[model samples]
Target chain A: MLEVRNLSVSYRHTWAVERVSFVLQPGQVAGLLGSNGAGKSSLIKAILGLIPCASGAIYWKNKPVTKQLNKVAYVSQRSQIDWDYPVTVEKVAMMGRISSTGWFRSHSKHSHLLVRQALERVGMWQYRASQIRELSGGQQQRVFLARAIAQDAELFLFDEPFNNVDSQTESIIFDIFAELKAQQKALLVISHDLSETLENYDKLLLLNKKLIAAGSIETVLTNENINKAYNRYLPVGNSDQRGFPSLPLLTNQKTPELQKSTRC
Target chain B: MLTWLTEPLEFEFMRQAIAIGLSLGILSAVVGSYLILQQMGMMSGVISHAVLPGISIAFFLEINVAIGAFIAGILSALLVVNIQKRSRIKVDAAMALTLTSFLALGVILITSLNTDRINLDEILFGDILGVTSSDVWRTVIITAIILILTKLFYKELEFYTFDPLGAKACGLPVNLLYFGLICAITLTIVASMQTVGVLLVMSLLVGPAIAAYLLVKELDRMMLVGSIIGAVSSIAGMYGSYYFDLPSGAAIVMIIFGFFLLAFLFSPTQGILTAPELKNKVFYWLRSLLN
Candidate 1:
């Protein structure tokens, strides 16, 4: 289990993420949804201790997890990596074991076996000797997924992984996430798309600079909540009524309700 | 051909120079492979020029110039990092800024001190012919140290260089690795100051490594091939200097440049001249235009 309390991240003088707090239970698949520049990456970075959190604390299994990076597996966006770096797919996957293998030592045969297994799981075993840049966008994501799979960490944090991937890759990743969840590993995934794919997550945390709402998919993803988070009049009604219920507009809440009642 | 090579080694200075050049070549190419992979090839240029201030300060204090140059090189690298952190200036710009300013400070200090003890030209261009047996020994020691460290920490260094964030997330001491890399680069620059001189050192550091990059897939192989290429360039350059009376450092750089050109055009896998894709594209374009 991971606990984040009153998490805040600031850049220069202004706050990018302000007073956000949430508890992620073990064996749960949580999704962090936000718009562009909505501090999603910043929040993930803060939780991972990649960037300093201005306020609040992060605890793992009731112990301080910040700076204890070895316990976590972080798969950054593929765009963050230099695809042109001179390395083979197998070599890239082998890096996941470098930390566990320790200093002044080469990777063990067991580590190599894990790397091969991870690559095969991601359907990338055939391209083990291929340069990383030669892989397609989805294939590159799979290679990165293979690296993460090889890590075998307790907590997995994926940031915007669905971008530029095919349906097959997407399904493969979701299956891994489900498998990790079944094994009771905590997972936090971030996505920008607002589609039915959000249904895969057991819980959702909506954000637009702050924690707009966080709860089970049914309660937190209400149309009213999304409108408030997206700050747009999305005209989303309840899922029972119009697929997903719309949030009451803060600007003219009384009018929409009155119109609904009159129509009823 | 044996005498052609054996004739030069008969002179003690020539033997020392060849040994120094060979070691320096291997060291620079191996280390330079890291630089090329990191895409910080120009960093060597920055360090080589930045050491001038340290040399000048060392001359003023009557200390070993190599020590001073090493200190100055490390200091300038730190300055670049500091400037990049505190301001909007990116790394390349910060490097360029430090390169010129540090070099200028060194020039001013040397000129103002009016010391006849040190000549700036010798520091910038080097005096390979003037290298003593002691210089050859020092190069050997530094080369061995670098080679041993690289072999010992190969996994960690490769991880840190390829994907620093991933390494950091894995709890590897990435910052320490980065600092160690800087120190290695400084030591290599200092060790190399005698043969290539500070100014021409970049050719040794980057030229051979880049050439080898075209032919290899792995960092280990790149380092090996780059070392061989660099050693040949340096020794041949030394021979060229002896027979043709050219400046040793300049001849070495010219030879390395020639190797780079050869690799660029003829490397089997990726070379422009050897790859069929370029020919196919040219023919296809001509056919389309004619149609």
Candidate 2:
């Protein structure tokens, strides 16, 4: 449902993300793996049309991305949001409908139902009236997930939604993603939790200033590939090594346990 | 108390003074809530001072003072917003730059206008006792219009003030909402200048709202309490000025200052000096050590 061609983004004199390219089909989740300041955020920002792109083109569902903006939904990193803001959970979730609802008229009843369903999906309906500041870190992350659900778009871009959330919340959020995939939606998730990302996503885009590798988890997540892209030492059986499941490196290991059980 | 109130109502000047004061108070309190929420108290102060030049220019041109002040306030607000967006200058420094330069221009304009017959005291220190019936009606009508408009766009305004980025992501025109807020603030300041002058107008614009902020958490309740405080303080100051022969503007400002101080010391949740735990072990230890 999405394709990118020769995308390059830079800030002033520094080249952040360079010469990146990939394609994502419907019902697929593409995981992005990179270190700090490795240009992941910049690429996402460029995709969102926030930053001026130096060079690149993006296609969403057979149309140019810039022309099909309303069809794209993004859940940005939670750190950019101010927790002390006076907005409520309901209002945040309803925000996703604004682009689609147009400017003058009030949101339609259908949009309201969608928002309610989105909240239900993330188990945040009880907190609808609650001020966003009054929620725990995990609940707050769930609120953003609900917002993305409310967008009801064909593609989803989640930027580090798992940061600061607990394991149970993360697992619950991944369940929501499974439902989205069932509906034939494409997802690009930027996560630091490489183990969860590798086990869930169908494809992995290993990036560090460039497109180090882009393919199935096994082919792209090898120890050699990660070492080449990151230039960092990784001890065998290290948690860091386990972080982005390089499938080819673990050929003898069974397929992802959760995905395997669920598929069977 | 009824007889005392009826006696004051009988005098024509006293009646007009009360009417004008009440109108200006309501306008200030309503607009001030949004300003305080957006942390734009300094911006309001800057705009209020900056309007002096526009008024002075209007005086020289022999045009209406309100129009000039409105134009000045809007123009300065635009300049400040633009500078903050385009340049690397911080908000505080940008506001200071805009306010000082415009105020300096106003000083120069006032000096230039001094060649003609002009009583600076009348404008600088308002004469509430001399407010004509036409002026009183003007204040009331303007206040009513502003209140209606505020009510109409209340939700959008609240959303914009609380979360600009979220609003933008939702495809709301964040820039337009911000500019609209500045315009509302400008109109409020212009209406208030008739009763409180530029230097003391802040007490009306920011004082009651801040006092209400200290006391309440909800936006709607804060606005209601702010308006009440504004109205009550206006009446008290007007009466005090009549009895003690004080400057009406200064008296009203002092009263609002007193309210702010009292609220600061006694508010339930956020009060500093009069908190619930002031008598607890923490305070006792600090006091004992100091002694």
Which model scores highest in TM-score? Answer: 1
Query: For residues A1-264, could you state the per-residue lDDT of candidate 1 as single tens digits?
Result: 899999999888788899999999889999997656778888888888877889999998887876567778888877678777778999999888887888887889999999999999999999999988878988998998898889878888988888777789989999988888999999998876555666689999998889999988778867677777767656543222332223322222222221121000
Show where candidate 1 strays beyond 4 Å.
A237-264, B279-291
Give the interface RMSD of each candidate: 1.3, 3.3
lDDT of 1 at B290: 100
> What DockQ results for candidate 2?
0.20
Residue-by-residue lDDT tens digits, candidate 2, B1-291: 778667777899899999988888888888999888788998888888888888887888888888898999999998898898777789999999999999888878888777235455655666676678877887898889878877776666665676564555445667788888898888888877767777788789899999988876556777888888888888788887777888888889999999999899888765887666765767889999999
Report lDDT per candidate: 0.84, 0.78
RMSD of 2: 6.3
Which tens-of-lDDT digit does each residue in A1-264 have in candidate 2?
788878888766778889999999999988887766678877877776766788988888778776766778887777767676556789878877777876555779999999999898888999898878879989998988887889888888887777777777888888988888999999998866445346788888988878899998778877787786667655445443333333323344422321210100
Scanning candidate 2 chain A in windows of ten residues, the lowest lDDT window is: A255-264
Q: Which 10-residue window of candidate 1 chain B scores lowest in summed lDDT?
A: B113-122
